[model samples]
Target: MGPAAAAAAAARPQKASAAGGVPARWVCALCASCFVFGVFVINRIWSVPEPVKLNEKALFVERTQTRLSEVYIPCQRKQNSIHIGEILNHVSQTHDVIMTLDKTISNLEMRLAAARAARATKQEKSLISADSDIELSKVRPKVFFVMGIITAFSSRKRRDSIRETWMPHGENLRRLEKEKGIVVRFVIGHSGTRGSLLDHTVDAEDEQYSDFLRLDHVEGYHELSSKTLIYFSTAVAIWDADFYIKVDDDVHVNIGVLGSTLARHRSKPRIYTGCMKSGPVLAKQGVKYHEPEYWKFGEEGNKYFRHATGQLYAISKELATYLSVNRRLLGFMVHRSQCGAHR
Candidate 1:
């Protein structure tokens, strides 16, 4: 309308500029505020102590229909921040968000909770009351399978021979997937591309079964820390799949034994099974591959590493929850035994 008012209007962002139902003005304000507040919030967030929840013990039921372990959380962490606003967060590391919907929605929440309670009751009825002598296959749930794999690659994250980084491991993984039924998958590092990584030769960690896969290393983007990529990738498995496993290409997996072992387990422990070692959590932090305050060393007791073991252990769905919940504290331990200098 007026010249002064028109100029002011022109400075404002368009309505379409807003994304995720937020407007351009809000987006601009949020961005500006975050730039100002990032250090402060990051400091506060980093200062927050992470949890120390142990894994929930897994029990299996034998039945034709399967006592499926399906846990659907009705109250998901809300993506929106406060009462009226939200940020576009693609968190590789997710912090559980809480949403308090309106009165009507709150009622729905109660209903859902009630339903979950009823389901728990049904489960209680289905479980053993006092019978230790009973074999469960009759009333037990059917077997359910979840499949995933893990391997390290060169900077390319593609399979190829490098000076000595991950080529052999990559080849072994391909063979494991092709020859054995053990599943394998790729990981792209998060902080930067793997290709840019300097060619550093690391000794072959497992020399037992080296001929299995055609291992050429491809670098995936992600920082290498003791538990960094493993924690993040395992956290993803928390969202999908019933069972998960991570393996290095040099490892030999006896698929037949693996399948039988899983099939027979009445209760599966959250374990770092292949090779177990323990130590305190490290306090050191990385700059480009930064470690958060939460990644501090653990209590005085020994802690074990599941990494050095040849990459062929099985985990049930429930274990995924623990990894997600404890990521901040357990995400960055590097296995130095695998590290070596370029030849």
Candidate 2:
């Protein structure tokens, strides 16, 4: 081969090698640039500043604590509110129970007070009745005036009140009977239920006091007129008196005034003396002064004939004897007659 051919070949190989090396260097430079960009991106992502990282951690902790506090505070407030509501409800219920108990206690106290008052009243009545009986035993058999106070089994308190106020008791009663020739007695009758507790109590009282004039008729509020008739008949049979007085147990009588008034009428033989009243005869039932057989009184609201008042009245011995003798016949007419005691 020629020198020129050999040189051309060497030049061609060298040009090829040089071209390949340039391409290799360009590839390595491109790979190095890509690696540097990846390293920069990793550093930017992982390698944060110390102060910035601490600030982020602190922010995260503060946000978590704030959230927890908000939740806990709301829950605690709700629990507190519920507890307060329950306490208020319990207090209200307790207050209502206390009020009810107080009312019950007040009622019991009132009842106890009433019972004590009643017991005291009964004891006072028993004492007065006992005193009256002692006085009655000293009275003489012969009396100028026989004052019969109408009474019943349940009228011990009324009798005691009269004895304490106007009627005399013990030594006073005995002195009055001895000085004035006037005898006072409580008039009563046996109970309808014979030998019952009521009758036994009355018997005990009578045995203790001996101031009661027991009647044959049964005791009843509806038979006042009949009781009055029986009283006159019985009084006449027992005592010899110038005047026989029928008085209600509830009446407050001035003994001095009564004695003086009776003395003025002592001369009259067939006298029936009392406070004269002309009240109307009540025919209606359930009335205060009701008359059962009011048809004979002329009309429903007709005024009765002027007569002695039934609460207190006096009859002469002759009239009392007449009433005693014809008591059975007078009993029928006593209620029908309008002239109350005079009839």
Candidate 3:
């Protein structure tokens, strides 16, 4: 090679290959350009009105998913020199990212809707001003048993099973209310999915059953404490019962036994009764009930603080009120089933 050619070759930046001999700089530049384009598209979409924005976003996601899947499916199945595996992986990751962003946007939209509903309810409450409110003695609901089942958006079958078997509804529900003076309600957060299919399904179920308490939060495994807090707060807002109870959906709650159990503590303030026990803090990463935030409790020797299991638990109106009022001050542990029990 000539000296001039050698000099020219040295001056030009050497192309670095990523996996499967694809240029790393090219991949980086493509990713960066896609990110910028995504941001710009999102900004433009968000500028529309709420109704239009939702429709537009849904359409955009559908089109994008279809296009990306069509483009990547061939690459995913066949081997190629252009790093098809890496491209497939990138596409999969991008889809996940989009889904996550969609969920977040949906949550924000639900919050706004919930705020509006709350405002309307508040207005109605102000108009009544307790003038038309029935006394507890006359109404006969001394205890509000809020079976705050930590359920998901897609768990319609489970909720239906609970409704058909243990928890009564329709005329049977009214009979229970009249006889036992105990009310049962299933609490759930709004859907985290992009479309409101789950939300609408739950709403339709509530219309038929009249037993669901929908909250202004997103449904997820780690959001149990927040959902519980909202459960108590909503209970207090709507009822003047002497006691409030929270139970899970999976637990078969014998309403008769529960009423008897709560009747004993009806007069007691700050009463928190349940099958309480202490368990060892699982510090290991892969164990069942592994504490991801284990350091919050203490060093390695610390056991979890004694708490009422999430299966079935009851609290007095006073304690529920305290929790409802002081939600901001309360610290929430991630493993909600093992904690959040307060006296």
> Which digits, one per residue and each the tens of the lDDT, describe model 3 over residues 77-130?
665746777898999999999878866764554345334333443443321244
Residue pairs in clash, model 3: none
Superior by lDDT: candidate 2 or candidate 3: 2
Between 1 and 3, whose TM-score is larger? 3
C-alpha lDDT score of every prediction, in listed order: 0.39, 0.74, 0.69
Of 1 and 3, the candidate ahead on lDDT is 3
Count backbone overlaps in model 1: 44
Task: Summarize candidate 1's per-residue lDDT along 22-63 as a digit string, tens digits.
Answer: 767988999999987998998787665432121221222233
Candidate 1 or 2, higher lDDT?
2
lDDT of 2 by residue, 263-292 (tens): 897755667888887767778888765776
Please give the ranking of all candidate structures by lDDT, highest first, separated by commas: 2, 3, 1
TM-score of each: 0.32, 0.52, 0.54
In terms of lDDT, the best-performing candidate is 2
Which residues of candidate 3, in runs, are more than 4 Å off? 1-144, 193-195, 282-299, 341-343
